[model samples]
Target chain A: MTALGHVPGPVGAAPPAPEASRRGLSGYLLMLPGTLWLAFFFIVPTVTLVASSLYDPSGTFAEGYQMTWHWQNYTDAWSEYASTFLRSFLYAGATTVACVLLGFPLAYAIAFKAGRWRSLMLVAVIAPFFTSFLVRTLSWKLLLSDNGFIVGLAQALPFVGEDFRLLATPAAVITGLTYNFLPFMVLPLYASLEKVDPRLIEAAGDLYASPFTALRKVTIPLAMPGLVAGTLLTFIPAAGDFINAELLGNPRTRMIGNDINDLFKSSVIPTAAALSVTLMAAIIVMVLFYVRKAGTEELV
Target chain B: MTAVASRGVRGWLGNHAVLIFGLLVLLYMFTPIFVVVLMSFNDPVGRLGYDFAGFTLYNWKNICEPYQLCESVGNSIKIALLATGLATVLGSLMAYAMVRHYFRGRGTANLMIFLPMASPEIVLGSSLLALFVNANLAGQLGFWTVFVSHVMFCLSFIVITVKARLSGLDPRLEQAAADLYANEWQTFGRVTLPLMMPGIVSAALLSFSLSFDDFIITNLNSGQMITFPMFVWGSAQKGIPMQINVVGTIMFLLALGMVLGGLLLRRIRERPTA
Candidate 1:
């Protein structure tokens, strides 16, 4: 509501109100329902549920049951799942790298090389999104099974050891995340790259700068915003995702997502909620940092 | 011009490298999907490696078998359509209100609408599951809970796409219509609606595909009901069934066909006006 008061009232649709109080009245009225829905569904549920994570099996909030905050639950979660966070980070980091490597060239080609076909390429990049991530990822389980094509290829690799099962490995987790988030990376990158003027590249060539040098000094820095956005999009989902781990990885490679989903369905709500809260906090911190760096105006 | 001065074979190769590299990238992007679709038709008597499967539709016929697996596919399509329609209407009104109508607390409202999208599905699915149980609504949680949950996610997508279009529009065009003695309703109907139709269609298509593909939230909410994702998941745990591959292949191709069709139709519509 307070944020709404800052908006320069609705400019076009309805007739303008008195100049003095327009922003306050129109802003507050229009923003009320959306804010209320968030309060009801998001803020309330998250806060209360995270609070309830302190409850022990006796349903008391504290050892003494005096409504004390038992911060030990947070400590306990770390002791129990110390490796899970590292695994989540490792998996997400690998996925981010893979998507960048796989997606950047496609984006570069689309932005610079393709003339009439840019929109069509974008449509193709986004088309796979029509299939659910679950369906698409699960389909990989069949493709990357012990008896699958990749399995044979792995065995054929000269120095590899015997009985390499690609299905239930960390490699599988990375492969799945990379496949799922490729479009997210490409879309934002294209948005940035498409804005780059073609004349600049020609000017660099005319100035006798090598193609490689021009890309390194010019194109990369210009597309930093999209790269940042794409990295966040890939990393955030990869960290939170339980699907890839559950469908593809061995127990050793299961990330925080698998941890949360595993605990939630098994009636271990408190600890699951605690992990979720911690994960949510990490995401919030990252988002705040990116917003500050990118500036509020850059992002919607 | 050093490469230009090398005007024979090497220079030609350098120029073509981008196109070649691009073709390779396109092939890479297209590979996993290609393998899945081709392998879905693997004949028992054909080559051991299904990098090439004999032209066959055996997998498609597997869906006709009298099993719960087939039922799940039907259930998934029905849920996706219902959820998409409901989300689209709610979201469009919200978009219209945000773009066209001035009201209070709009910033907070906007934040609330988009928050569901950024909030991870794990949190959302569990929260909805807990709420359903605590509220004693599991009996009614079958389709209704799933539908509502899908709308919560889909609505933000709809609003974003439509709002993008609305912002593109010149505000004075609508104002000019009003100045010519057209009422607000008539102005919207005759002017705003026709102009924003492309975005509206895109939003609907996006919403439908999203709802169709959702698995996590649907799984948490659907008690005895099974969507295609759950069916594939449960079957994956047992061992990846041949038929599930069939389902996946069909879904992928069907999605590709529909999206390409929609783009083509939009292109046709644009030409007449252009």
Candidate 2:
């Protein structure tokens, strides 16, 4: 929080001279546009969100003119959104687990076995991201079609009877989340694993340590920071995202995103605001929990 | 000797186990996207998919047939470009100021700028909606509202990218330029500009992509303006048209091509330079 006096103070090696004053003025001028944009949009809007939530139920301004403060807005929305939040949490959590279970191995391979192709593999992980998320998701819809080739394949499975429906299901939403966020998990894990010293593992072996013990003690602990960061990165977006849930999930399995969305569309501003605040708070709490459990500095 | 050899075998299995698991993750990550790319070719006519329909360009043709796709695409391109440009310039200046100059409420400013990034897109859309309604601004919804919102969203990304680059840059470069008779403008133009170009370009590109792909904010803000995503949303409600799959496939392929091209260029350049 550089809310304190943040100024360029004796930054350059140049002997403290007449130029210092000029440089500071120019710098301040340079910063003005961004400062204006932030204050006008970010700060003002945040203030608006809080004030809007407090507006009485009759409307904040003239009756129905604006959101009137009603503390109950939060409580009312909570019951509606509680299951939604739980569903979102479950989807997000499942995605995180899926990424770790799926991503760690690929990361390990790239870091160790696929040495020369590591860059190419890394690029592949990031490649899908370059394209439109909407497009990629739409493709999932196509592939998961009842008569689509993927389903056709599923039907071909032994003893599997009836049409296979992949799209419009909770599993589809989870799959989409995992598809989108796997890269977040893999990249960080790769970064950490790549730096792991092989000699240390050898040293452990020389001390008669079992292979399981070596990995459990050395690799897991050392990679804990990346794992934590990756989990946070995946979990936050998965929980907050409305895209996957919208595209892949049916109405029966609405997540918190759907709840917020309904509120927004219906012009239920205060309740929507409360839900949003809760969502943001949840993320902050998760981050803090991880930090406390693993220590802030070590957990990335 | 036997013990050592057994230890070697155990290490191999341990490493291989991780590798197998990693491959599984990569496969899962890829499968859905891969499926999308593959299905983009299938001609969808409601309950029909990939029947050896013998690949048709009809979907791409359909883009301009019944909808204002060209208009939406053009609008998307224009709005994204303008938003990217605006966000880049303002964000870079702010980054320079925060990183290079003294400013009061710097922490407050940083938090303020980053706030939009943390809040959900819907909140921003709603807040802007309220702001405009209260202000009695013309056009409750349209391209302008969308553009402004895009700019607001892109600003955070640009600021983050530029600030990071600014933080890492050596202040000495600017000082030296100034000492040698360069004015503030000249120093920034010649010295600071070149170093920040990579970051600035990346930030711009990222914002452009974001603006182009945006759905939630656009859906909320647009009154009648139909962007590519709006078109997709409407079509999706009726079950996605094959045109979407075709368009999506093309976009994904294009992205892949650019990435491969970039990699090839890097390889060739590095070979010569090294």
Candidate 3:
């Protein structure tokens, strides 16, 4: 489920016709518009962000920033917002783990058990997306409200008090993140699990391997590409997400995204740019490390 | 015989354990959606609009009662339509090029397409803001800026979706069409386009949804204009109108209808003719 995994076979695999390969000019022509759009909006903007990060910190929107190339902006932003950055990753990590746990059984059942209802089940999984994201998150706020049933149920525990609440806590932010991104995990997992040959599992069972053992050994290894893809998809967006934190979390639970947004709004352009660049760089580094460790470099 | 029957019952339960668990997860996923639907009929007595005060048809009947809500919805629809159209056409052409014809720097082109998906929205939004700021377009940031960004991000998804469909096609079908003495344009129009329609349609649907629901990037670029998500965000800070839930419920119903309608159409088409 890497971005290119949808494309069949290896890159530059045999063209359908010899003339297809020779018509490179047409290929380039077809690519030109999209390529130029990406270059202008994606690539150039990214470069501008890096440059903005180096601008003089003292400058304001009114004063206009100068190209001071001040390297300390990185250190300044990092030193000030390190905890927020760490919290974002921690929340995102927890959300990814939660999504995997919740999503796996659903994806598994949809793939192996649903039979004729598979597509319907898949649509059901994505149906939540039809609603507005904010509205759904708002419903979560209702669910986790202090006087809500969920909190009342939580307060019933022996260790919990009547005052126990789910909202305005780190738990709330993480729950919101997990809920929002669960489909990302499930869809990829379903895609890969759907491809797993049923005969392989039957073969394992015939070999006297227990169901759990077969799942751990046979099913999981085959679904690694989707697992890796799903986790990255969940983690990357969760780390950068501010809506969950802003809506569900208290001020103390603020993530890097919240800080970056606040900084940008307050006209601290250089610091905000610095934080944005740092977040992107950190995510890229972690993704590379993860892809390498997962031994699925080819998928990417 | 009693013991054997008991063992068979146990086997049935064991087999269904995963299915039961999966159903519970699905329930959890749909709970909020149910809440949104339920809230559309809520006659809230307070500003928070958190609880179901009383069930009434007022919110649904007067959906446009809230100031600027309908206007924002209109803006979102316009943006979504335009962005989806542009992204689908450009992306399908690019996907066709990538899959049907081999070219230099294909690897680099693929990487360029993939990078935007990998990057977080915060980074993407902030970087674009930075670009506009530096380019002296900060004052001009509004609908067009948001539209450009929407197309920019939607392009990658469209490419991937259409590329998957294009590459999955049987080359022999096109070759057969050519063997029948069909011209290039004729072969493409009659064969390739029809075969690729499902992918293109899906890509367009995906792009429309993404553009319509976008907030993070839109929030950064939308200086004075209010889109639906932006309006929702603004209301979240102040007071939420119950009509917002009405809008949410409508979007949900519309999309679900389209999907189910498409599925029914496909099933009809796929049925063996007597």
Predicted model with the maximum TM-score: 3
Estimate, for each residue in B37-135, the C-alpha lDDT of model 1 and write its tens digit.
665776545323323336667766765452577888888889889878876776776676677776665566666665666667777776776566445
Q: What is the lDDT of residue A71 in candidate 1?
A: 70
Q: How do the residues A43-116 of candidate 1 rate in per-residue lDDT, one tens digit apiece? A: 66666557646646344221222223767777898788878988897888899999888888888878776666
Segments in model 2 whose C-alpha atoms lie over 4 Å from true places: A1-23, A58-68, A111-113, A149-165, A188-216, A219-225, A288-300, B1-24, B45-52, B102-106, B136-139, B166-186
Q: Model 2 TM-score?
A: 0.82
Docking class of 1: acceptable
Q: Candidate 2's interface RMSD, please?
A: 5.0
Pairs with steric clashes in candidate 3 = none
Q: Indicate the worst ten consecutive residues by lDDT in candidate 3 chain A.
A: A1-10
Stretches of candidate 3 off by over 4 Å are: A1-22, A157-159, A293-300, B1-6
Error of 1 at B29 (Å): 3.1
TM-score of each: 0.85, 0.82, 0.95
For model 2, residues B90-184, the per-residue Cα lDDT tens digits are 98887777676665666667656655765556667667665554555524679998888898889988987887676667777788998999997
Per-residue alpha-carbon lDDT of candidate 3 for residues A1-300, written as tens digits (9 for 90 to 100): 121112233545544532344364788998999999999999999999999999999898876899999999999999999999999999999999999999999999998888778779999999988988988998898899998888988899899987788999999999999999999999989988877777777778889989899999999998888898899989999999999999999999999999888888787999999999999999999887766756432343
Sorted into a CAPRI-style docking class, model 2 comes out as acceptable
Interface RMSD for each predicted structure: 4.8, 5.0, 2.5
Give the lDDT of residue B103 in candidate 3: 81
lDDT of each: 0.72, 0.72, 0.89
